[model samples]
Target: MISQKAKYALRAMFALAEATDDTPLRIADIAEAKAIPRKFLEQILLELKRQGLIVSRRGKMGGYQLLRSADDITFGEVLRVVDGPLAPLPCLSKTAYHRCEDCQDEASCHIRRVFANVAEATRDVLDRTSIAEAIASGQTEAMLDAQ
Candidate 1:
């Protein structure tokens, strides 16, 4: 399961993506809009900024904005940033793979084989679904339906 931090991050990103103007959104505004706690939102925003997912400014006109276009940012990327690898098992992780301590052979392990497929399918959908696609009217539902 993805962490609560990841869910908040996505909500914050969606709020930013929905911004039609160039104005940055304040942390309080994002928190209220997304129902995320203010302090937690600050931490999440800083992490996102460090990862180059969003940018922040200072002063009265200061807030946060997407560093990249919404269409260019995928759900998988954000999830990875906030929650680490998507793999159900460490051995199934492509970016952070670690062999199971008890598994004798990864090549023949039925558990590994099953989870590999789960991880692949999860990655496929998340990587293909962009923030823009998600916030668009009816697009997310249609995409899932087709999947």
Candidate 2:
């Protein structure tokens, strides 16, 4: 499960993506728009800024904006940044792989095999799903639902 922090980050970023202009969005505004707690949104925004996923301004118009286009940012990247590796098990991890201590033969490990598939599928979806694509998909789904 994605942490609330990651969820909030996505919501905030998605809001930025949807902005009609390149103007930065105030944290309070984003929090209010996304129904995120103001303090928690502050922390999440800071971490996102530190990761270079977003940028901040310091003046009267100071706020936050996406550092890259929404189409250039994938859910996989955000998830990894906010939640760490997508692997369900250490052995299945691509960024932080480790042998299972109790495993006799990695090749024959059924549990690892199952979770490897899970991890791969998860990564495939997340890595391919950009914020722009996600927004478009949601809009399409909503239209379909309405029809």
Candidate 3:
């Protein structure tokens, strides 16, 4: 399951994506619009900014905006940035792989085999689904259905 922080980050990204105009969105506005706590949102935004998913501007007309086109930012990227690896088990993680202590042989590990498929399928959906695809009306359903 994705963390609440990851969910909030996605919501915040969606809100930013919907803002088509050049003006950046304020932290308070995004927090209120998405029903995320102001304090928690601050931390989430900071993490996103650090990860280069978003950039901030200072001054009166400044706030937050996507660092690149929404189409280029996949849900998998955001989830990984905010919630770490998406693997269901440590052994399944490509970016942070570590052998499970109880597992003697990876080739014959039944549990790892099952979860490896799960992790791959999950990555397929998330890496293909971008913020642009998610925010469009009817696109989300169509994408999922096609998948």
The residue pairs in collision within model 1 are none
lDDT of every predicted structure (CA atoms) = 0.89, 0.85, 0.90
How does residue 107 of candidate 2 score in lDDT?
95
Alpha carbon lDDT at 82, candidate 3: 93
Writing each residue's lDDT as its tens digit, candidate 3 over 20-138 gives: 79899999999998888999999999999999999999999999999999999999999999999999999999899999999999999999999999999999999998999898754
* lDDT for each residue of candidate 2 in 1-147, tens digit (9 for 90 to 100): 777777877888888888889789998899888788999888888888898999999889989999999999998898788889899999998999999899999999999999889999999988998989988877623422343
Question: Candidate 1 on 51-142: residue-level lDDT in tens?
Answer: 99999999999999999999999999998999999999999988999988999999999999998999999999999989998988546434
**Clash pairs (backbone) in predicted model 3:** none
Model 2 residue 46 lDDT?
85
TM-score for each predicted model, relative to the true structure: 0.92, 0.91, 0.92
Model 3, residue 13: displacement in angstroms?
0.3
